[model samples]
Target chain A: MKPQRCVAEGLFEWPSDEPTVSGSRCDSCSFVTFPTQDACPRCGADATTPTQLARTGTLWTWTRQRFQPKNPPYIGTEPANEFQPYGVGFIELPEGRIEARIAGDIDQELRIGMPMELTVVPFATDADGTEVLTYAFRPIEG
Target chain B: MDDVAIIGVGLHPFGRFPGTSAIEMGAKAARLALTDAGITWKDVQFAFAGSYEVDNPDAVVNFLGLTGLPFTDVYNGCATAASALSQAANTIKLGEYDIGMAIGMDKHLPGAFAADPVQYGVPSWYGETGLFLTPKFFAMKIQRYMYDFDITPPTLARVAAKNYRNGARNPNAFRRQELSEEAILQSPMVNDPLTQYMFCSPNEGAAAVVLCRAEIAHQFTAAPIYLKASVVRTRRLGAFEVHSPWVPPERADSPTVDASRAAYEIAGLGPEDVDVVQLQDTDAGAEVIHMAENGFCKDGEQEALLSARGTEIGGSLPINTDGGLISNGEPIGASGLRQIHELVLQLRRAAGDRQVPGTPRVGYSQLYGAPGTAGVAIVST
Candidate 1:
């Protein structure tokens, strides 16, 4: 049987005050995927090992919505079931992969490729007052 | 690439079919394609189906009991149908099978037409998926393009006006009605600068095509339209990951441009060679942007090119002759083939009220999906 890797356990190890990220190193193609997995998304290689990804990445593309999104992504209130603009785009990691998210500034001048860094931020709070934090990439200057 | 011909094309009218499941709608299209090809279910060699929300595998399995043919399912967001056609064409090109079928169908209740953030996941601190809506996401790209090119809402309205006029002739279209510039311009704002009419409504439908090796195309139909080429690509370059300078040298070719270029290369043709082009019209500006990006015009020239009568029905290169997603409605999985089916119909001289004048010797269809996946195919009479 293949060894099991529980995400919950991994999340615990990467908890705040001790930040960590996930990735996979493919033995066959040497391809790596962040938010690590047992197989490579590039070459379909199952020969993979879990590894930690860099805490920082480059901002690939970004846009802010002037409206709100349906189902509310992280923790913003639904804008009356109507449009509430927001921003989102890809963030390229040092490993050459990307992730999407809700953007901060709407009018910030964004280019195609730019240097950025990752930070753990709060998404939304549950009824229990448990503030959930998620990852977001921002301009390094921020 | 081996020669391949489209023996038949079929579609369930594009509109809101909240009453129908994607599988049911897909089956209807598959059955029609089967009949149109003059082939019974038993003669099929292989099949491919596409959908955004349906189970990836069951999309193929559910059809087995209907068409009784072996098949596989594909899911690639909005380009689902086009991807299915590409797979089927590739299978035929490889000589693995002389005949193959591809179908795409979608209903929006489950995943709708936007990319799923849960699938992409939030890193924990970064929350709120408000920017993920289809309109908002595309608006970002459109806004950037508009800012770079000095585009106005009226310029975008021109595309909507054209598509609505074209859709007026499409009996199966959803907003088959007409819209004036003022009406389109005044519609509620889905995305700022992108009015209500500029956006495609949630549509549900399906489309299917029967493909065969070129040499044997005559067996299915004496006048089968040949699928001259197919191209697919993803924008893993500077377009998505980081904010690179929009400078030409630094900015790589967009996925749509790259896919169309590859397709034209494969077909040994250029945009000028294409008599009719059916491109994705999920958003009004999409048609204009694709027209230029697909080589119908130079970059940032779609506004002027289209305004100067370059893309009308009787103009040099008529596009989206069957109304477009704006008029016909964006039917997700069915949209890609719907574009191809329109091109095929035009090539076959079967587009009645919406027909382009003269014999359309060559045609092209394209689809844009999932922020970066672009698929294209060239068809010839």
Candidate 2:
């Protein structure tokens, strides 16, 4: 396998198998937040602890992005001619809802409340030739 | 607390002005406002300038011949002007200053606002993954809203058409041409349900307002619009907004709701008292959602409101009488002040063609923006 690195450190586990997004759960309030929070946003307590978020969830909402985003930060390697529209939305995980780029054929029909599973995807390649990976959600297969 | 009154309002029309620097536009608006209030720049005791693209809105004071007055620069996303206005009003209300000025100006490139995810507490990886879609954020919000409320595409189209029609009557609006509902629907799709014309572009403009304690109002203008309330609030946890990668299942009151509720509480007036209204129409869908958030109507009632022409001028509840950001193009920092300028014009019976009839007594304006910030202002004749 090609050498790969996660887009942002500590956002999600790498290794390309058994992927899980990281989050923070408040011990006092039972509130959860993605990418981890030092302090609970709900109760303002410092009891937030690291937790792996659910890998599957329901599609709460979605929309197709038709325009090419202004890049500097959007380091996707897709050429302008080969660029295709994509879906983006919030997936309602058991821990909490998280926004993600929807992977797979976006032209296919999508509906709210469909089951979705998290998957690691290629974001870009760094100067060191390391594949930068980011997490996305796709409709779970039967 | 002293009652604050807006004695003068001015605008450097909402449109692109390539050669005009933000400072020059801001100075022009300041001069117009000072002239309208029959006061020299020297008489202004305090100033609050709001801007995003403009490096230093306070620098405009040099062009206006500064009188060693206290000037503060503020930036609260798209609610920049509202925050400035709120601060200016509070300065007068607290009896710290008898007369003050609030101005917002910006010169932006033609596109969606260039925002960094890191600036809003999002990880850089969020943007790297191509999840930094502002229009899609709006579309997703309205999509869920539509799913919950059963609102149709035609209703959204009608909202844009109403604003466009109203924009045609306002000489200062950026897009003064009226668009039909059919035309709006047929416009190229931007995000799924939103069309190209349904979203406002980031453009250039400046607006200013001269405010004074109600006791000293007659010294400025014969018609002073009383600032009943001005409030600014940010999103709490679980409130869905632009740039947030995740939201808790439990929803919190949006910033608009929090700000609007506080504004009405302080003003001792409800939505029923508002004769004219201005809402943040960053997109057509935003206007519909905001209508409910601002307490004008309940959720799921937008379709009926749009179909009945209730939000049009001369209707029961005229909204965005000056065409909103949808028609005016959002100049970020100056957008909220532009709404205040319109309300002032309407209250004084100076809004010639786009005037709301029946001696409008009260007006309300709400502006919601990126990274979760909202501002609400209630004014009365």
Candidate 3:
């Protein structure tokens, strides 16, 4: 088995079992942001607190990416020829709505307000044989 | 600020101009506008040029002789033209420059705009994960609107067909062929609710307008159109916008909403006064959403207004009389000016085959850009 790591540092917590994202809460304005910020974007307050985000939430809105995005910016695991459509959505956590890539079948039914849970998945393989991981949301099974 | 008047307008046909460089296109439009205004390039007091890809659109001065004037380059994403025109108008109202020019041009390659997240102050990971694309935001926006407003998929198709119908009549439009609702609906689905046909292509074009103090506009042209308002606004904190990693649950007015509200206030008019309208139809859903955002109708009222053919060229309130971004395609910098061009022609009763029936007294144009910037302009004959 290859060693694994998160795609970006300090984005979320991953035990390879239960994954939860981190966010920043402004002590000045009580504004919250995902992936955690050092300062508040709303009130420009330097005093911020790192808060753990809920792993479960409801779908706010969603769409599919049918075309291959431009390369330099898009470092998706799939090549143009092997590009698979993926679901993109915003999930409504208790604190804030976070934009995220959705995991599972593209053809799967994804309705707004449906239950969803956070998960970590393979993003890309490095030349050093390390597996890069990213966070995603999956529709919780009934 | 005093009211400004558009004395002359010109456009470089929007499409694939293989040999013409963007600077050349911009120069052509500027020269034509100068010719139409009966003024030489030397007569212009100041000029503002808009472009996205072009490093310095102000470089158009090299093509048009260097008169040693204050020329500015503007790049506000899709709302570039609006900023150019607004600055020109404000300059005139300041009593500094009586006559000035606002010109915009861009030659973009085929497909969507490739934007770096860092440029917009968004995280690089947003672009890396492929969620930063503009089309997705439009699709998801209209999709959620459809869900909340009871808009059907066919209604979106109808909006595209209407633009195509208008485009087919306009000789200057890029996609001049009229598509049926069935054809538009059946087109390849790029984003869930928006199909390939529903989205506007990023193409090449140029447009220019010569503006002066409204009091002296009659000296240049017989039918001068008064610029009632020209304004631009950015996103509020709680609004949903492109290139965002997350959004606040609280809803806030979009830039279009803010700009349009300010424009109406400045113009002392409302949607009812607008006889012809040109909106940012980057996609068919955009037109629908803008119909509400610009205060033409309420949020869900489009579901009813569209069904009754209220937005057709001959409808009570004609929209996109010369086709919209859907037909002309989007040349980032030049797009908003194209809307102004259409409004000038319609207000002057000069639009040939696509003219709205009866004399139009007021015309409205709006432009919405990435990272949440919006521009709005109102004109009257």
DockQ per model, Cα: 0.15, 0.74, 0.74
Answer with 2 or 3, whichever has the higher TM-score: 3
Residue pair clashes in candidate 3: none
Q: Can you give the lDDT of residue B240 in candidate 2? A: 88
Question: Lowest-lDDT window of 10 residues in candidate 3 chain A?
Answer: A71-80
Indicate which candidate wins on TM-score: 3
lDDT, residue B207, model 1: 87
Q: TM-scores of all models?
A: 0.77, 0.97, 0.98
lDDT of 2 by residue, B9-35 (tens): 889988988788988999999899998
Instruction: Please give the lDDT score at residue B111 for candidate 3.
Output: 88
State the weakest 10-residue window (summed lDDT) of model 1 chain A.
A1-10
lDDT of 1 by residue, B118-176 (tens): 56442322224233456655655676677677667787888888888888898878787
lDDT of each: 0.71, 0.90, 0.90
Worst 10 residues of 3 chain B by lDDT: B123-132
The list of candidate 2 runs beyond 4 A from truth reads A77-79, A127-130
Between candidates 1 and 3, the one scoring higher on DockQ is 3
Evaluating just chain A, the predictions reach TM-scores of 0.68, 0.88, 0.91
Pick the winner on lDDT between candidates 1 and 3.
Answer: 3
